[model samples]
Target: QGVKVSGKTVTIGAATTHYDVSTDEKLRKACPALAHMASLIGDPAVRHRGTIGGSIANNDPAADYPAALLALGATIITNKREIAADKFFKGLFETALKEGEIITAVSFTAPAKAAYQKFRNPASRYAIVGVFVTKGKDGVRAAVTGAGEDGVFRSKEIEAALAKNFDAAALGGLKVPAKGLMSDIHASADYRANLIAVMAKRAVAAANA
Candidate 1:
């Protein structure tokens, strides 16, 4: 597993483990939100064994990487070609990888300000609701995970609000409709919708902090 940096763009080997991603000095500097998100995934054992590519390849609905990757506009590098994050995730436990396609690395230009926040399940530690927000060349992006029925997705409302004012308070009184969100024993669609807003606000706060 390796991480390479060229100017503001950073490329991380697909085999790199969550632990490595969480602690790599270069990655931490280049993508603090990603590193912090990695740090919050699973337990120590899982962090040491779970690879970033494997996680994204699995495309688990509750996985954290997709939120940060999507919000950061990361490129998924595969043996066949590169895929944009927006086009990568298909749905629950699905991705754009083809039969013979293999992921090699994931790359992104570090954003100016970003952070991720998740409300997690106590046992498995998967996100019940997660949000990652960034303000950079893309202006502002807010990606939500663990709530959408179609998996990770951008919140246009949150993005528009942040574009107007990139602050946690800017999201005040914001509401995310529960129509397309998931409902489980842990949380209802309405509950996750509330979490989406709460987590987005927290993520913006962390980015500013």
Candidate 2:
């Protein structure tokens, strides 16, 4: 029904639906950015029907969950074993999941401050470029989705800047260069690179707010 956050970690069952994640009071308190991201996915109807695990297992390059999970340093538990988020995602619509292995749940250590910012594609409502940022025991981690040619990826430059100063101003001069980023009909690699920086700045602002 709802997600589970035990100790410093949060877990969402594979069957747990998106609407539940978006509305679960405990989950909201534990990780507001995750809940807020759930709320922003598609519309009410879509949110009602989508499952977090489904989105995660699909590993869509533009999907929201991958960015958040990666940035949060989450673990994906499956029928076989547990996989770290960093190792879970392989590429666009690809994952470390084997032929029969099923994702049971995803767990993450809740960050002290975290936020997600997305530039949506008008019709699809999918992220043209999305950024997820977190500051916690692991320090600051920044993950970018929808722009990477290889799927979701961590931005070391952004993380380094935010790790030093967790403020939007710290990232003002920094840039996510347009290399190895995807170029699609909706957005060019250069445009997505720019979006990455802007979204990172906005995400930092949102985390502070």
- The numbered model that scores best in lDDT is 1
Worst lDDT run of 10 residues, candidate 2, spans 1-10
How much is the lDDT of residue 135 in candidate 2? 94
Q: Which segments of model 1 are wrong by more than 4 Å? A: none
* Tens-digit per-residue lDDT, 1-209, candidate 2: 35877887788888877888989988899999999998989888889899989999999999999999999999999999999999999998999999999988888889999999999998878999999999998699999999999999999989989888999999989877898999989989999989999999999999999
Can you write out model 1's per-residue Cα lDDT over 43-97, one digit (the tens) per residue?
9999999999999999999999999899999999999899999999999998999
Q: Judge candidate 1 at residue 190 and give its lDDT.
A: 99
In model 2, state the lDDT of residue 67.
Answer: 97
Residue 185: error of model 2 in Å? 1.1
**All candidates' lDDT scores?**
0.93, 0.92
Highest TM-score among the candidates is held by which one? 1
Worst 10 residues of 1 by lDDT: 1-10
